[model samples]
Target: MRVAFNVIDETIWFIDRPHEPWTVQAEARAAGRLDDERLRLAVRSALARHPMARARQAPWRFWQPGFAWEIMEEPQVDALSIVDCPDDAALARIRSDLYGHPVPLATSPPLRVRLAHHAAGDVVLLGVNHAASDGLGTLRLLASIVRGYAGAPDPVPDVDPLAVRDLRTPLALDGLPGRIRHAAALVTELRRPKARIAPERAGDGPGYGFHLVRLDAGDTPALGSRRPPGATVNDVLLAALHLAIAEWNAEHGAPCERIGVMMPVNLRPPERRNEVVGNFSSFVTVATDPEDRGRPETTVAAVTAQSRRVKAGGPPGALVDVLATPLPRPLLLKEVTWGLLPFVLERGLDTAVLSNLGRLGEPLSFGADAGDVAEVWFSPPARMPVGLALGAVTIGRWLHLSFRYRHPLFDPGAAARFATRYVGALDRLAA
Candidate 1:
């Protein structure tokens, strides 16, 4: 049986940014098979293997099986041309475009794939509507496509999106008021003054250069040296970001005690393994104060502890409950007023976001005899107010970092500098 899930307030925020397109491009050596028949067969097999591609959603459902594919075969359709712009600019354009083209709930598809084929090979651009599928979902679809091409029995049967239980049930946290105050105090004490970096303007050109930096597995040991007990690479990355913001603030002469980092929490559990679909995420802010004179390890430990407390206290679930309630117009307005609590809590917070997807395990290899999968990375949406986004994923032993920023808010030089500083901070912690 299917049930229509009411769109939450967070989903409304997603709807407002219509131009923030979530796209992924996979470029590989074509091996001479770029015919229409092959493409159709590939897509048909992909659809069959990735059942989520064909699932449809009503007002209450969270996803629809809509997908589109286009094959471009012109000399101008170079692989470089397909992904020329820096991911951040591409992301910015999507968000800007989204603001203008607010996609209504009814017309948007759950997925889209555009293929640009050249004499060299092929580049597959997979775009998913953010309201439905996320990075994990995209990877799942791609894996299924690869497997289907190889004639593997479907990896796993598709679970109806509606059938997944919402673990975000409201919980009673009677003493939560004090804990919330303590969390706020921790943020305040750790708050750092940060200046917003201005991004470069989009040039007359159609695309920009894209580059990547992968930290080696050997480097992990060095970095782990300084990590306090219970601190993972994620904690180290968060610390680096905190330091970067502090330095940026120092360089720009901005207040150093007001910056905040938005951290997304994945709410999925082990039992719901196959229910890997849609935006199953919520967030908490880690406030930093550069003026605080604690060692980097201590700062991270404090932040981690606060995060643990918040997670244990279950405020995220409470938020889900509050937002999910079906209220009348007056009550909805009241809820909106109350929802401002996040903004209030985050006032003077730096508009940066950090997300870590950890490792992706083995590359999804179709029965292809060639090209081993090397690395994978994803850049989540970085809309305005939140002008910078940092995403990391470890494919095998290589840690891939994708830093996305609004073009108008950061120049390539600044971005490069920021990346270098972040790496340096990580190295410092490792040492």
Candidate 2:
């Protein structure tokens, strides 16, 4: 059994190579001792339900009629691994695998799991191929694995636009007026200036590192409340990022123009927010204003205004969808060009991205054997050119702030300093 993937899937399949596989890294702690047997069984059951998990991609060639995933009866690659090491070492190992250990994309399941056993407890790390699923989709997959392991009911199948097109309602109007409006929005976004984050010529080389900081629950919500009325946590965070960039510029002495930020907006339908997996996200671009960001308050206000437009389905988000529309595109050449830039630029020297998973849809847990989820964090993939990315996750009261980056542009020392500045930016709100 096989099916053709959409263009977005095609793009990910190409961008992701063995050494630089586009994968999402996630960690969750179990409640008690986790049963390896149950975990293994759960994987098998979950794979049985989702054909994509046990599928293989056909080789890519210019002449290939079309790209497709051939479904298989059983998994073609290892699904899980168990390691004995300290918690810190395990986290390091997981971080390394994003660019070090390549996922067998052609034959293996699009995801892999590892359990690191330390004196304190186990940290469950999941590595999911971006071509197969995004971060939230992996969470859903993880939930299924846990439920299956704990002798609970299987996860409900996600909605498939292809499978139920006729029965399902259309997402938006495709009339001439609507199309014209979408096109206009795309043009406006294209005209918006982007930021130039200049690092020393030598600082933009290869190699990568991950740095993390935690904010207690009390302060996490404060990040949003302190912003102007109606501003969300996301708005405050973006404002904080702008301030961090300013500090970085001051520290580096690299005077540059605008610094554009591209955020991946969750586009999954409300019904599928929790259950559906796969790539249901689009990009929205917003640049920081020095005039407004001059002060922390003005910065938050400026960001809030721009972001509100985006949340209301403005140009930035519409731009991604216009280009990401599946093949047989209206304007093949144009869409294949500008429409594909976001995917390329995010990993290039154009803009930095911040993806906040907000909060886990359901409590992270298994049964009595494995404890409830104590903490959960994910790192957005960072590759060369575009050397830095910040991913955030909030569990109960604690907010986990992660800075994932590629080397030269930012060494461990640089990321550490940026982390300090990031937290400091948030602190400015209190002052």
Candidate 3:
């Protein structure tokens, strides 16, 4: 637990920019709920195996090389336990509570859980601080806790970790032209104007709206076959999202001719994505034009083509040259914090961030406590500078989608309506 923050971790912290409660909140809905004590104890045990989970900020001298996460012990397991809430306010309560709880740097553990009971079953909200971990890391932690709570003895991986290969340098190839092209593309992107964000409605607060909807089994797999024969489900979803945003904007009188789509691709090497527990992902923006929204086949083709081009050019994070730097910790922080992001997004950018976590290979179970998970919804951070974010995951035949957006950029009811439009867009494409 005494590891120093990596370049990516420091970048995430700087992006958090004042940590206005930066968190990635998710909901796991299951048919049966685990007892509070059982869930709490399971989390406590899981934390023990992953000391980084309970790592807190410790004192460091200015020239101590890098910032380290110091392991800290907790007084009570229930500190990260669950709470029951009425069915009516379940979603609202979960978002409100999770959004407000940013595991401060000095805090022991940057994660929390809350359970809400409905007539159907339970919705467990897992909130994790982004600076400490990403959405996948949080999901991995939850999976381990569920396994532990289910009475699986020694749920932690038994093997020694693979030798630490630099995550960004996993591939060794000279693509100088590609790198130059990427740099030029980014410069062009920053100079070009973007689409307008959704207009705000009366009473929209500073908080983001959360909406989750499930696609039936019939619709889920169909997404894999939309028009383009080899296009993945993610490509289809991203295409559909383009249409949904355009439609939503048109309906609201703020029609956008072209929309920017940002998808966070897991940058962890093929073998280490599961082993690593941190923010190891980079943004991949696919092309979206106003014309594609009107023609379903063209939209899929455009998305599939653009996705292929981006991947062939480089892995998700091929252009982040920070991995090559060996500078003083303080100077590195100041450079990334002060020089990079603000130069690109000084004016808010109207964009959609879609993170497709796909599925857990197997259904999630909480052993003797909570039964198999019924539904799962995950959403990446909906930070400023971006207008909309969508997270998608499939559990069994159900494809659960969650739309996250903050105010002024989106009205309180915007997420719900956007989701409805998204479903409609998916249906059109799946047909």
Model 1 clash tally, residue pairs: 28
Residue range 1-431, candidate 3, lDDT tens digits: 36666555656655663324567776777677667777778778877776657766666655555666666766232446455666646657666667645656776776777766666777777777776676777777777777777777544444432223234454333554544555555555545566765665734355566766778756454475433576778888998888887877777888587677777667655654654456666555675777776698788888888788767765433334333345446645556544665666544243778888886777887664567888788887766657467888887778888877766466557667778888888778764
Candidate 3, superposed: residue stretches over 4 Å from native: 17-20, 60-66, 72-78, 153-166, 171-184, 202-204, 220-227, 316-340, 347-350
Tens digit of per-residue lDDT, candidate 2, span 270-338: 777655556666566666656877787887777778887766653443543454443453334433554
When summed lDDT is taken over every stretch of 10 residues in candidate 1, the lowest stretch is 72-81
In terms of TM-score, which candidate is strongest? 3
lDDT for 323 in candidate 3 is 38
Q: lDDT for every model?
A: 0.50, 0.65, 0.66
lDDT of 1 by residue, 1-431 (tens): 23333233234333234343333222222333233444445555655444344443434222332222111121111111132233445543532332223223343234554444433334344545555555566656655554555556554535655445353342223445544554454455334344454344433221222234578856666344546567667777787788777776567665555456767666565564323555565556665555441566656765666577666764432234333443334434544554664466434445687877777655544356423344455556555545677777776678887776655556567777778877876776653
Q: Report the alpha-carbon TM-score of model 3 versus the true structure.
A: 0.87
**Model 1 TM-score?**
0.71
Name the candidate, 1 or 3, with the larger lDDT value. 3
